[model samples]
Target: MTMEANELRVSESVPVDTGQRRGTRPMAPDDVAAVGRLFNRIFRRHDQASDDDLGRYLQTVFFGSPHYSPELGSVVHENGANGIDSAILSVPMAFMVNGRPTMARLLCAFMADGKAGAVGAARLARTMRAARQDMCFSDNASPVSADHWVAGGGIVLPIQSLEWQRSFLPLTAAAILAGRHFPIARSRVLVGVLRPIDRALRRLRPSMRPKTEGECRSEAARVEEFLQCASAMLERFAIRPAWSPAEFDWLVRVASMNRNLGTLQCRKVVLPDGRTIGAFLYFGKQDAAATVLNLVFEEGRERDVAAAMFAQLDAEGYAVAVGMAQPFLMNAISRQRWLSFRHRGYFCMVTRHADLKEAAERNDIYIGGLASETWSRLLTDF
Candidate 1:
C-alpha cells in the first residue's frame, strides 16, 4: 500500500515549492518512545517492545556505549517535533589509521523500509556527513541502501563476511548443500537431526575430527593478553580500528546483554616454550553452534594460531565451527572447508578525506561484523 503522506521536514517557517523540509535534529531524552515506535514501524520483530523495554534498550544500547552522544544521531520529524519521520543511529569509535588513533562513526539502524523512506534516507546522509566526525561508515547496508549511499557519494568496499563451518555428523551435509540451493533444506532442521548423531559419534571415534599437529597450547585468555595480541597482530592492516581495552570490554558486555544468549570468550595460544603467539575470541560453545569474534596473531605465526584454534575447538566438543569472515583470517584458513557464505554486509563509507577512502579501498582498513554495528553484535550470536 502506498503511504498516504510522506514525513516532511521543515527548513524554514514558510514552506518551499519543492516540498523538501529540514526537520532534522539530534535525538533527545524525550524522543525515546517516538524512536522506538518508528523502529517497530520499520522492522516488525519480537512483538512490539513495551515503552519500558524500548526506554531501557535506548539507555543501555544507545546511551550506555562510551561513544554515546545525542548529537551524533539524526532524526527527522515529518509531522513536526512531536513525531519521527526517519533516523539513522551511529556510534563514534576510535580506529587505527596507519597505526594512529583516529575517530569514526559505525553507522547502523536506519530509517529505511518505512513510509517516508526516501526523504528520511537523504536527510540522514546529509545529517551524518555534516556531523563532526572524521569518517562515517556502515557494515549493515543492504543492496537497496547500498545503491542509495553509492549515488550519494558513498564508497562500497569489497569486503565480504566469509563463513566456514565443520560438520559433526552427516546431517551437516544439509548446511553444505543448503548453500547451493537457496532456501532449500532448513539449517535448523539439519542441525536438529545432527545433534543426536554428534553425541553418538563423540563416544565412538573422538578422533574423527581433523587433527591438528603441533605443540600449540590454548588457555583462557586474559583481557590484557588479548589486547596485547591485537596490538601486535593488527599492525599488518594499514587502516583499522585502534582498539581499547575498555571498548573491547564494553562490546563483550553488550553481547551479554541478551539473556539466554551465547557468550564471547577469549582464548590465548601459546607455544611449547610458553610464548604468547596469538589470541582468539568466539561466541557459542561446544556441541552447539559458534562463531569467531576475532583471531589475532603475529605475521609468521598464522600456523600456530590456526592449529591452536582448531585443537581448542575440537577438544571443546563443538558441534559446528564458524568464522567472522574477515579476509585476513579467512585467507589464512582458506584450506579449510567453507560450504557456505553470505555478503555479511556492505562496508559503505562517506568521507570527505581522500586518505580515508584510499585506506579502505586498499584493504588497509580492517572491519568485521562484530567490530561494527549493533545488529551485528546481536547477530554474532548466530
Candidate 2:
C-alpha cells in the first residue's frame, strides 16, 4: 500500500459529511506493514526522505508490541476501494505538575482526511476525555494539517525552546581549549564519528564503577534509576521485537553508525550479591575524547548513577560539563557545579483537531517535540 501521488489525490478533497464512519481503531499486530507503508508515503511526499530512513522511522513505531498504548495511541483508516486512505498515531507520555501525572503528551500523530475531520475530531475528543487531566497534543504543524486541525477547533500551543546534545566533545577539554565556542566544533565531529563507532561498541561493554557518596547524596538519583531500568528492559528481557523483522538489522546498523553521537550507551547494574538487576543508557556529557556515546542507566537508576558518574568524571579531573534541557535527567545535572547549562534556541507548535474543544478543555494538555511526518521520518537517518 505505498500510495502513489495520483491515488492519494482521491483523499485530497475529503468529504465534510458528519456521518461518515472512517474507522479509527487501535492499531493491531497486522497493521504494522500497512502503517509503515503509509508513513513512508506521507514522509516521502513531504520531506524527500530516503526509503532507508523511512524504514527506520517505521521501525521505531511498530517495534515489539501487539498494540502500542503510548497513553495516546490510535489509527484512523478510511473505507475506500484502496482501504484506509488516512491514519493517525499517538504515543502517551506523562508530564507532572507537583509530581503528579497531570499531563499526557501525544508523542506521535498523523491524519489523512478532509471530509471526516469532524468524525476524527469526535474520536480524539473521546480519547482525550479518557486521558489524564493535563492533556498535551504534539505533532509537526504541517500547513495542510494545521489548517485542518484549526478548522476542527484545535488551538496551537507554544513550546519553551528546543534543545539537543551529543557526546562529540569532552566539555572539560573543550572549555580549556576554546573557552566558549565548543558546540560549533562538536557538532561537526559527531557527524564524523558516527560511522566509526557504529562499527565498534556492539560487543564492547566498558567497565563501570559503583556509586560514590557524592552520587548517593545527589537529586540525580531519580534520573539514574530510570536509566538503569530502560537498559535492563532493553537487554535480555526477551520481549518480542517491536519493529519489522526485516528492519531490526537496519536499526542496529543505524544505531552503530550513530553510537559515537552518544545516544545509546547502556550499562548493566548488578546488586551487591551480584544479581543483574538493571541497566541504563548514559546521557548529558558532551565528550569528544572519551568515545562514549550518550549513556543510560536502568530507568530507576538514572538519578543515582548519574551523580556517581559525574562524581567520577570530576574526580578524574574533568573540568566542565554541559547540560542540555532534557527534562528531569538534565535538570538533575544542572544542580551540580562541574556541569553548567548551555542554552539553545527554538520554539515548538502543537496541533490537534479543532472540533474537540470540549476534550481539549477537559484534558487541559499541550503537546510538543512533534516533527512533521517528513522530519520525523528524516530523523531516522541521523
Candidate 3:
C-alpha cells in the first residue's frame, strides 16, 4: 500500500500466485470473522486478552480502521473448510520520503501454520511486495517471518533495538534476568532479600520519585491528540512518515486496542500558559511494566516532558518501563540509566525504486514503535 512520490496514486492491482494450489488472494470483507478466528487460535493462548474480547479487537485490527485496503492485503487458501490458512494485513501509511510526502505499507497480522513453512510464507511475502510501489516493510517480524522476508527480496536493517529500564521493581526485573541466565535464582528467599534492598535504594534517592504537576500533569488524552503531538515534533532525521489526520486517527485508534496485554495510555504535558508542549502514548502492562510506544515533544524541551511523564508513571505504581531509543527520546530515557538491548528481530524492507534499506541504516529515515505494527499487534501479546 504505497503511493508514488509527490503524488497520490493508489494501485488497483492485487497480487495472486500464478502456479501454486495454495495461491494468494486479496482479503475479502466477509473474511473478517475467519481472520479473527485464525488469529485468535494462533495467539490467544499466549495473549492475555479474553477470547471474545480479542475477536472484537481483531475485527478492529483487520478492517475497522481506515488504514486497511483489501487490494493491498493478502491471504493464503488451503484445503480447510474456510479455504484460508494464513494472512498478511497491510496499512497504507503516509511518509516523508526524500523530503516529499510518500505512502508505504507497514505489514501486520502476518501468521502461518508450521505446515505452511517457508514455501507458503515466501509466496505470501512476494505478493505483499508486489502490492506496493514506494516500499513494503515490517519491524515486527517473528524469526520465521524474518526468514520469509529475506526470501522475498527484503533486506533487514542493522539498527539496534530500543533501550529498556527497571526502576521500582528492580527485584522482579533482576529475578527475571537471573531466571533466564540460571534456573537456581528462582527462589522465595532471593526475592525476599532483594525486595528489602530495592526499597532501601528508593529511600536513598529521593529524586527517584515521580513529580506531581499542577498544570503540565499527566492526563487521559485521545489518539488524535497523540498524533497532533507527533506531528508537531519535527524530525531529527531527513526522512520520516508524514501521516494525514485520517491515517493518524486510524493508527491511534488501532493502537488503543491493547487488549489485556497492557492498558492503552496517553499523557499530555501542557505549560502554564495553557499550551500543549509534549505528549506520549504508552502501554501500561498488567505486571506494572510501562512500555512507551510513542513519545513526542518540542525539540529543545524533550527532557522536561520526559521527566514529567516518568514522574507521573512512578506515582501510578509503574515499577519499570521500556521504550524504543529514537534519538529524540534518548536524552530523556538515558538520564534514568535505561540499559540498551539488541533488537530482537530484523527491520526488514524492500523497494524497487529507492534505496530504502540504505536510508534506514544511515538514519536518514525514521522507524520506531508506532511507525511499525508492533504497538498494536506484536508487542501487545508480550
Q: Among these predicted structures, which one has the highest lDDT?
A: 3
lDDT of 3 by residue, 1-382 (tens): 4523322222222334553234456667666666666666566544232355555655566565565565544454443333556666666676776676656777766766557433545556556553245677777577777776676566666553444564655765566345534746645577657766766777886655655434565667876787777775756555576867876767766776666437777888888776887888788865346777777778687777887788877777665666666655665566764344546556677665555556765666666666776566544442
Ranking 2 against 3 by TM-score, winner: 3
The TM-score, computed over Cα atoms with residue i paired to residue i, of candidate 1 is 0.80
Query: Worst 10-residue stretch by lDDT in candidate 2?
Result: 1-10
Evaluate model 3: give its lDDT: 0.62
Going through the candidates in the order shown, the clash numbers are 11, 66, 2
lDDT of 1 by residue, 1-382 (tens): 0000122122412344656544555666666776777677676553254367556666566666675555444344443433466766556667777655666667767865355555655665555442223577777678887886677666787544335555444355445336434644535666677667766775786654555546778999765577788877788787766767777667667765543225667799888898888888777544455566677787777766876786677677665566645556655565544234556566677665677668777667667634665324333221
- Top model by TM-score, which number? 1
Global lDDT of each candidate: 0.61, 0.38, 0.62
Q: Candidate 3: list runs displaced more than 4 Å.
A: 1-22, 32-54, 78-82, 116-118, 128-133, 147-153, 158-160, 173-197, 205-223, 235-237, 270-276, 285-287, 338-342, 377-382
- Error at 205, model 3, angstroms: 4.8
> Which stretches of candidate 2 lie above 4 Å from their native place?
1-23, 46-60, 66-72, 92-106, 113-161, 164-263, 267-280, 283-378
